[model samples]
Target: MNRQDIGFVQSSINYQFKNLQLLEQAFTRKSYSEEHPEVQNNEVLEFYGDEILDFFVTKMMYKRFSRILNNELVSEKNEGELTKLKSILVSKESLARCMYNIGFSKFLYLGKSDEKNEVYKSKSVNEDLFEAIIGAVAADCDWNYENLEKVCRTMLDMETTNGYLALLVKEKSHRLGFG
Candidate 1:
């Protein structure tokens, strides 16, 4: 990505990278790295990002549903129930939807064939990009929890109570006949 494009991305995500290379690496696919040996792929970042996202979202869930988890709320939930909700929030499909909604997965640096095939439109690709970005932020911020949390909240639109996560929960409840 060019400087202007990267700037736009930073602005859109509301976070700037201390090491710009990490940001660049986050968007670089393994295929792209194969074509350009000098560049690193985002696979490692994606892996780390997967863990970071899980940790961050799980923590958020524990905090947000404290009463339910502790059996204090009217709709008390057990550990398994909370786990199910967390799984839904961090699922690949949910992350892909968030990335797609952001409308920036198209900027991913892909291999020639993948680019030709429009791989960015794929759910798995979108999911990877989402995690890759979080991974990038984790590295750039020196593993600061606040920075990671902020980025996740911004990218996933989970700042408000009625945000994407809440909507997803409502949808899941309806689907499971629990609404």
Candidate 2:
């Protein structure tokens, strides 16, 4: 991506990149990298992002649901419950859906052949891109937790809820310092 198009990406994530190249790398896919040769693909970046997302979600869950985990609630939860919540929060589908909602699908630098590949256009690709973008943001911010957290909050659509269960959880989460 050119420096000129950085505005669209930044607008979507609500974070400006100190290193514009990192932002471009986040959107670069293997197909594009194969042809570019010199430019790095998002695989390694995605790897870092995957771990970051897992860590962030796990930390958030532990802190947000400490009452249940610590038996502070009337209906205390077991480790299994926490595991389920973490799984759901960091699931590939969840992250992919979040990214798609952010209009990231329109910005992927896929090659012509990949453009027609059904799998390449699937949620899995979005999931990979989502994580890659997270890694890019983390790198852009020099690994600052606050900066990364803001991107995660925006990219993962974690700022809002629609379902009944989510609403209930958000309501109860206030006791755990979520609000």
Candidate 3:
């Protein structure tokens, strides 16, 4: 991407990249790179991002639900509850929805064939691009907690996660006779 593309995306996201190439690579799909041959695709970045996201989501769940582990009350949290919440937080559907919510759909770079198409509108493609963006950010920022946390808090749909977790807590409380 040109400097203008990087500038536009960074300005929109409120985060600047130390390396614009990494950010550009994040949006590059195999089809695009296959044609260019010199440009790198986002597959490796997506893989790394997936693992990093799992760590962040898992950490968030552990911290958010720490009371369940230490509480003596019947309304305490459980492994199952935390697991369920984390699963939803890291799921492809949720990530894609969050990406679209943030208006990153227009930035995806596909090959000439799919360039005109809105195929990036697909949920799975959005999810992959989301991961690629995470990977790109991680590459630029080095996976620091502050950087990753900022990305996670900004990109993940925590409000939806909270809603589901709230429901879980309510059900548990009801079963415990507190509701």
Candidate 4:
């Protein structure tokens, strides 16, 4: 992608990275990285982003579901319940829907062979790209908790507006027997 395309993608997401290369790396798949050894795959960044996402989501859930009594549930049950809720919030399908709705696929760098596969249309690739992008943003920016929360809220609001995760928070609350 050219500088213009990168700029466009950044504008579309309302996020600007100090290091543009990080964004480029985030969009790159392992196959592309293999072909261009100078570039890196986003797998490691994705790993870190997953943890960051979990931390933020968990905090959100705790605040949102304050009625849930800690002493009433077993440790395993609490963990399982939180996991289920987090899964709904951070699932590949939801992330992919958010990315696609925002025209992220236009900026994605895919191998020629992979582009032809039906699997590319699936949610997994988009979700990976989303996580990678988050990782890149975290690494490239001096994003504090407040900034990260703003980004998460923006992403979630977009998803909710698009109906990708409209009922997720409510449904999870109901399922957990929280008002």
Q: Name the best candidate (by TM-score).
A: 1
Tens digit per residue, CA lDDT, model 2, 1-179? 55556787787777998888888898888998898899898998899899888888776766666655355553344687777766766777777777666666777888767887744558899889889999998888888999888787777663223332584587589879979
Better model by lDDT, 2 or 4?
2
lDDT of prediction 3 = 0.77
- Residues 72-133, candidate 1: write the lDDT tens digits: 55434578777777777777788887777767786799999999998999989988988899
lDDT of 3 by residue, 43-158 (tens): 99999888888998877766666644355424245778767777777777788877777667677779987776767888888889888888888889987778877776666652
Q: List clashing residue pairs in candidate 1.
A: none
- The runs of at least 3 residues in candidate 1 whose Cα sits more than 4 Å from the true structure, single-residue gaps closed, are 67-75, 158-179
Per-candidate TM-score against the hidden true structure: 0.83, 0.80, 0.80, 0.77
Query: Could you tell me the lDDT of residue 94 within candidate 1?
Result: 80
The best candidate in terms of lDDT = 1
Badly placed stretches (over 4 Å) of model 2 are 2-5, 67-76, 118-120, 158-179
What lDDT tens digits, residue by residue, belong to model 4 across residues 66-169? 55456652243366666776787888877888887777766676766666774446689888877787777788776567656766666655573444244666
Candidate scoring better on lDDT of 3 and 4: 3
lDDT accuracy of residue 175 in candidate 4? 81
How many clashes would you count in candidate 3?
1
The local lDDT score (0 to 100) that residue 41 gets in candidate 3 is: 95
Model 3, runs deviating above 4 Å: 1-5, 11-14, 67-75, 157-179
TM-score of 4: 0.77
How much is the lDDT of residue 30 in candidate 1? Answer: 89
